[model samples]
Target: LRINDPGIDLGVAAALYSSRLEQPLDSDAVYIGEVGLGGEVRPVSFVESRLKEAEKMGFKQAYLPSPNLPDSAQKKKIALLLSPV
Candidate 1:
């Protein structure tokens, strides 16, 4: 899971570590957000596109910022974990 983009994905990294230490994370879940230095999850741009792409690839859940949620995404089957930083 190498990300070539310049944007940071701290939330995903933390989730991966958690998965490694505890029970494995849901295979159907996709985590998308940035974790700040103070350990806060932050919103990113183009959230709708990201979730749509994840759904297209068969992901059943997405962890993202609450403020970034799109109305269109609610119509999809993907469940959202809206975090507030």
Candidate 2:
């Protein structure tokens, strides 16, 4: 749980971690989003690039904000979990 990147957004990651403490997250899934104080997940910038990188790195899924989803994501073959902030 030690984060190395200060610039990395962790709102959604924190929520996921807290919610899934009893169960581990999927190893092949990448999570990306900002969390609001009210626990809503918000979109981040460069979502397409991030998803592409995750796909290239062999990730099978992603959890991101709905607003961050790219139109071309359907072609990437990665499962997406979208939430609203």
Candidate 3:
């Protein structure tokens, strides 16, 4: 779960929380944008390479917004889970 704390950057928060909560963040690095009031995790640009990097680093899954899924990578060999805000 994401908490919207203006003082904390979502990227750092997610990473730290993932570590603290022992979540499956794995080697998947995040490129989180600004956090929203409703605890929404805003999206950045093309995250395909990010996903690929995560997969390359032994991470098999990615969690991001549905619209962020690259069109060309829609059928690629990777695990991308969509979480609605």
Alpha-carbon RMSD, each predicted model? 3.6, 4.2, 6.4
Per-residue C-alpha lDDT of model 2 across residues 1-85, encoded as one tens digit per residue: 8874322555346556667886666677677876667766667777777777877888877777777666664645545444433
How far does residue 35 in candidate 2 sit from its true spot (Å)? Answer: 0.5
For all candidates in order, the CA lDDT equals: 0.67, 0.64, 0.56
User: All candidates' TM-scores?
Assistant: 0.69, 0.64, 0.50
Which runs of model 2 end up more than 4 angstroms from their true locations? 1-20, 72-85
Question: Best-fitting candidate, measured by lDDT?
Answer: 1
lDDT of 2 at 73: 42
Q: Per-residue lDDT of 13-80 in model 3, one digit per residue for the tens?
A: 67777789888564534443446678676665546666666566665445565556566545456664
Q: Model 1: what TM-score?
A: 0.69
Candidate 2, residue 18: lDDT: 61
Name the weakest run of 10 consecutive residues (lDDT summed) in model 2.
4-13
Q: Give the TM-score of candidate 3.
A: 0.50
Worst 10 residues of 1 by lDDT: 76-85
Ranking by TM-score: 1, 2, 3
lDDT tens per residue, model 1, 10-78: 546756788889977778877777776876677788777787787788877676766767665464544
